[model samples]
Target chain A: MEVEETRLPGIGLRHDLVTASGRRIGVVSQSTGARHVVLYDEVDPDAAAATVELTAEEADAVAELLGAPRITERLSRLREQVSGLATEGVPILPGSPYVGATLGDTALRTRTGASVVAVLRAGEAIASPRPDFRFQAGDRLIVVGTADGVARVRDLLRSP
Target chain B: MSDAARLLVELGAVVLGLGVLGRFAGRVGLSPVPLYLLAGLAFGTGGLVPLDAPEEFIEAGADVGVVLLLLVLGLEYTAGELVTNLRRQAPVGVLDLLLNGLPGAAFALLLGWGPTAAVAMFGVTAISSSGIVSKVLTDLGRLGNRETPAVLGVLVLEDLAMAGYLPVLTALVAASGGASAAASIAVALGVLALVLVVALRHGHVLDRAIGTGSDEVLLLSVLGLALLVAGGAEAVHVSAAVGAFLLGIALSGELVERLRPLLGPLRDLFAAVFFVFAGLSIDPNDLPAVLLPALGLAAVGVLTKVATGWVAGRRAGVGPAGRLRAGAALVPRGEFSLIIAGLVGGAVVPEFGATVAAYVLVLAVFGPLAPRLADPLARRLAVRAAERTAQQRAAP
Candidate 1:
């Protein structure tokens, strides 16, 4: 009998991808971009992963399962660059210009090299802030950028 | 008609007159609180429908109003927003309090009142007029600006400070009242803690319960919760207002949004009665004796609060217009001040009570007039500052 496959949203594979003997056949990696989710999979430990891009609808369904569409998008974006970036990991405070600025201000963009993808304020997520958004005093910014870029942005924000 | 019937008739008449006067005042851009107060004055000591009640009864009613107001205030909790608001306003709040309090205390001493009386008076004057400031800021469309959150934060701190000060001052006035003071403070802190913990933990549950399709249950439960907390506070010797305020803090954000439309009108009605009763408490005969002191205090209260607000605004990087607006906003004192004064009077010497009432009456009259003064002051200050900047630029 053919085993049923399970597909996850922003991240790729739908298959249990478990072998007949219960051996794992593949790992699915999901990442997000500005407007879409990129999904690809690793078939074997020694083999290069096969990249499978999912449509926006597929990504939204997976995002709903993950309970965080914004995080899903962010993870999908990161996964596009790195095939196996963990989706469930806690995001560290980004080194971005928005570190000190209120979540609503355009100053976040000016101050940090990275665009603020979202903000976690008072236990809720605020995504894609407008130019006039005031950065609250204690808001945590989630940003998207290169590792070095994230570091630079984080440094600027972390400075008193 | 008997006294009870006459009292009801007077109250109804006052309410009707107030509704008309309030509408006129709002149309003309004045606040309704002061109008209600003035209407109280007109109907009570200053005009025809003279309903002379004992000071104790009116004061008790005012006390109840204060408690209810505080309970309503408790329903407006925004702990989630407090960090941002507090961080922005801490410096301004501290500076405003000191700047206002020091001078006020000195001024009181100059009037030859003893040190204790002077300090209590300073507390009364140091309180920035919350009603006036909020109303004018809203009217000017500046309530959502960066400066406003800070100003409001400072006001919250001031309110908390006032809560701490009230019981201590009361105890100082009557040494035997120390136990009640401790009890009140303890209850206040305990209630605050309980409300915050519960709100933080089970806020979603409460939100869902409130949202469930039972309007009567929701109203009753909310009111019942407020009263229960208030009763607990009262049992421990804390003011009902403290409990109410804590409840308001807890109910802020989603809860406030849900409950305000339902409860706001009721709050206003009680508040109106509160002010009218405040008005009714005053005796026409005593007005002459208290008039000069009241006028002096009112003038000082308005000027000092404005000056301190201006200083705080400037320090917070507010522009000249903004500074002037802040100053104007701080001009009107309200129910809180009167309530504090009554507490102080009852706790200390009864004579001081009369003095505070006269001062509050004066504030009620002039508080609404402050915003009218602000528009011209702000424009004039802006023009003057701009001219000075232009002159300096031309000099170079």
Candidate 2:
């Protein structure tokens, strides 16, 4: 978990850490927002075995893909433990009335007895989003409740 | 041919020639600077074919080139990073100055070029080519090396030194009297200090002011402001390049990144023109005479730079091989060296221009290859150390 941070003067900052497998890996975050993933050579610790340059968008996608799935897996495990309890992902469409509004504005829990547990945006999970957590188009809200409550929450989200 | 038509034709040919030269340099894995100079020399006075482009156009372009070069250089770091590098590497930077600069000054004095030429030569030899060094690191996949930060630290310090040195040298070059020169240096330093303060504390305010607006508007404002400040600084006897550099430092935040791509092509074009202008100013005939001394200075330059890098790497706690790579990485003297020589104006010595041209030519071409020497050199040293240890064991 320990990482070494090195400032590259005019270039950028590099943060490298050694994995449990004895592999040294680093990400150089450049001033221009590009990221370079560097794997250090075992024979020569000073040199890199491989370097991958990623654009800002590509880096975001990589981060999202790496992070988002864990939340889904944990939630899916909980769903298996309870027979009546259910979870459904409801995405905010462009035409939805609450697209730009906060989660509080919907009051889905009061209306349908379903709780919005988390919001997934760009592969990042915002857990236990507060009332004021704003909704953006394409945000996937994880609603958890009884199967009927979850289906009603999804219908409400799709319409309003 | 009409003057306008002839100018267009000549300018078109020159631009195309530069493009070809640059491409060839790229293919050969060399900095295009030396090749640009060669192209300039070929078309300059007493070469294969004289360029018929208006003198004023090239002069103006070259002037803008220096400004853009300095501006872009300053934009590479924030004021905080500059301070951090200065704080951490001050000793190494000073060593770099003394070890590399003194040789050039001594050589100039030995050549009977006097104090002014010594000052000029000091700048020429002291600074490493950051452009070439950075490219070499990227090319060699050494950007992630342990010694790279140390190498880059040395370069940052050198650049900071140049910001201060250029203004003082400009004052010295312009003023004949000792009192006036001293006064001018004081003024230059005062302006420099004031600008640094503004860059550090009030940078965000300037950023907000200059950084807002569309790309076109931002580019125009920044470029216009640079020219205005450069002219103002020139009027006050500070180097115009320093003024542009100060402007770059003052404007920071997200704008710096955005401005980089917009200004990059502009910087490249003008920078090439600056190199060519430097070459055109030097006569090819004068090169032969100065070649010997320039070569001598270059050899000394290589050693001193290596020494400087060695010290820098050691300070950063790099091992022997990494230290050698660091040392070799600091050997090239490119744009800044030429800039110093150009600022010298050949008033100090008749051969100053030619000497610097040859010196830069040798170093710029050789600098890229110098890093390759690091591994072999390190192995040789290791062998010698092993031999000495074995001899000691045998004696006992």
Candidate 3:
């Protein structure tokens, strides 16, 4: 992935990433620790098509959306350190086995070595999600463990 | 009817008229400044039906409008940014002054308004409307453009320069010549420098004073603080606008941001009233004689302002298209110009205010629209230049 970064002299840093499908995603990290996730115009990349301001928590959630956690330096080391120990997001699609089920009901964290550490819903991060949290379709579960454990958790989530 | 009752009734009608006109402007996707000004003219003395009421209240409200406009503008940048921008953009700022200001001064002198009027009109033509330009940027969604920061730099420079310029002009226009005049001008400069230094150094005093709450107390405190400072400046014979601007520069961080949403609506309402008061002060009959001059100034205004943006944007390494956009963006002259014209009063040529009002009305309407109007033209020129470059490369 090619990400272009520029320092916005006196303001902060701006980073732009062009996804494989040619979607240009921009993130402006302010000096004040605020972040603006800007969607650029498809034709004119300079103009912002949309700008969504994110709180600290939501910005972390967005990091997960970008694939691996890439916000802080420790997170970057975690990406390499946990290589095959796969940290991945599994979506709770409609008609999936996990729909309407509680995290405790899944029992998959115990069954497989994968731990559901966080849940992303409605653009919010529920960090260290509780066992009692309800599983809803469109919920993105961020799981961390061995590849085998993550695969098993994915299967558990997909099967109705 | 009693005098008070008639005044209240007339004021009510005026407010209603402004509201309706503002709504219409919003519906049609235009700034309501010109419309509001025209409505003020209609309701003013020497118009079709002048309002027969106490206008003292409106006059005071208009003064508050100027202070708030500058204050909010100052709130847009931090004191540090102001200093850095002024230093970095000094050359462009000077060029902008020379290009845009020279014409107005020359025009005033050529029209035989004398050196004093020439100086006053120079201030009028030189300063761009930070208020109107900001609105236009937001409205056009050009806040993220490559050249916007450059445009903003130019505006900030103009504002900072105005802080000193207004005080000196106030002194000059107050008295044509005397040792007392020199003494007052020096005093004004000293006060301005003192405020700037205090703002730059001990601004945290203001920060702590403003507190964190975003309620009515915070609102009243902020408003009161501005008025107190503005009043103090006016007492010292400097423009109250400078006082408010300096105060805005002193307050920064989260407090400024929190104050914005609370102050936004109030700023708009009072700012509209301020424009109306300006229009009311001008007689309609004087506009015709000045209209031709106003038009000529507008034409000159475009060239000088565009040249300013070009120098600024090019120096900042912006492309031709972006530079052109910057130039057009700087075209509108609104609040500050009117305030300067107001300051001069009848000291200059009798029709000075009329000329300024007409000039501003022309530019205020034209300024915001200039960028959008220039976009396609700039793109075409850019495309042609790019084609030429490609042809040259192919031949080689």
Candidate 4:
């Protein structure tokens, strides 16, 4: 996916990402520690469909899931790798290979040993998703496991 | 002790005491500014222990502190950036002045401080502490929030307003009421415009003139130029602080980045002196008389500052939570307010400084904790509001 980021002057940087299905994801990155991810209306790209704002810690968690957490945090996580514990979020969008598929069909857990701890949809939390649980667009899957295992699940859900 | 010996001992003791108090404030997660003020009061005349030193020496050091405070503030933005912010956000700035400034002026008049004190109080109340606000934003890790830009915008305008305001305040204090005051104001306007034009047009020229060859040369040249400009401005009846600020504006860009490490410590040291000096001028006994009004003024300040921040954030389309956070970040008044109070010291009622000291003490303590407190406070308030609306709708 090609992501275009534009600096908004005194404001911040706005990153516009288009998924393969043409869904637009806009993330505004503040120079400090705040990042707001907005889903744009399909027809009116300027209109905000929804916005998920995150603080530094929360954003750092998502960044770790995206495989690009801050250097310091990454180093700390590496030092703590003895526990083989990690956490990240994967946004469910249209055209994602895992969308519309049941968790059982994806074989994500079998392949990566990572488990979907929760599926958050429209502000609703669905915990410990069953194998037959269906994934829908905009559902954020909270995957937890070792770093390598989490990466595998992210690849399965996020990448086209 | 001899005058020189007394001065040396008192000055050293005050600075050291301020250092200890500052560390305590830091440990307690509060701004050390109010503590510095309190320290000043303890050593001032008619206070707990009157300093035996010649007051002129501390006053001179305080002057330098004021210059450095405004100077470093100016260095944070390029002249171009300042101009752009001024043009776009002039309305918001005007709104801030009207909403925040009016209360101070009205309160002063009501107190019978007369117009002179009202003008001084107007300035003291109007400007938010760029120093405190910036520190809070950074400490809270809120620099990236949606409402941060709006907050910065207001700060820039307030600083720019100071460029025009300080000169007027100086002229007003000097001439009191007469044609000389008008003349002084005109001269200030001329000086201000000329400084702005030179800064915007020839800032790069200055950057080259004050070459960043080595830190040593850079420090001497930058400090030398600021002092020279500030002195010249004072000679011409323009405020020295404004002169230093304009010089900082001219030296903005890569120069500021280079000078930050060199100047940061010096600015801090002198700025501390400035706060202590303001405190030193006040009599602690006077605070008892003005404490009630000062508290009321602070209440007004808290409300107005929050309102200004919220309105500015809303204009920028930030959500309610972010808006509240921005408002919280803005509540504290620090260095600039002290500088204003110091400037108007004898020109206003003798107790005016005490009022300012009391007011600042409260805000400084409140400002640091605002960001931490804002989230829960905003949430609870918002929840209660929602419940009230729901009840109202369901009743009919």
Off by over 4 Å in 4: A1-160, B1-8, B380-396
Q: Candidate 1, residues B185-216: lDDT per residue as tens digits?
A: 56555655676677656666666665655667
RMSD of 2: 6.7
Ranking by lDDT: 2, 3, 4, 1
lDDT of 1 by residue, A74-151 (tens): 656775877433222123345544444554444545564566666667776666656666665557667665555566
Candidate 4 lDDT by residue in tens digits, B124-154:
8888888888777655555445566788889
Q: For model 3, how does the per-residue alpha-carbon lDDT over B1-396 read when each residue is reduced to its tens digit?
A: 998889888888888888999899888767788888898788788997787674788888899998898788777667888888878889999999988999999999999999889989899899999877867875775555556678888988898999999998888877657787798899999999999999989998888877756588899999999999999998887889999999988988878767777777888888988999899999998889889989999999998999999888888776677788889999999889989987888887789999999999999888888988998876766666557767998995
- Off-target runs (Cα >4 Å) in candidate 3 are A1-64, A67-160, B212-214, B385-396
Clashes of each: 39, 0, 0, 0
Residue lDDT tens for model 2, B267-302: 999998898888888779888998998899999999
The true-versus-predicted C-alpha distance at residue A60 of model 1, in Å, is 25
**What DockQ does each prediction reach against the true complex?**
0.02, 0.33, 0.14, 0.03
lDDT pick, better of 1 and 2:
2
Where does candidate 4 clash, by residue pair?
none
Taking chain A of candidate 1, what TM-score results?
0.40
Query: Which consecutive 10 residues in model 4 chain B have the weakest lDDT in total?
Result: B138-147
The whole-model lDDT of each prediction reads: 0.59, 0.87, 0.83, 0.79
* Model 4 RMSD vs true structure: 13.9
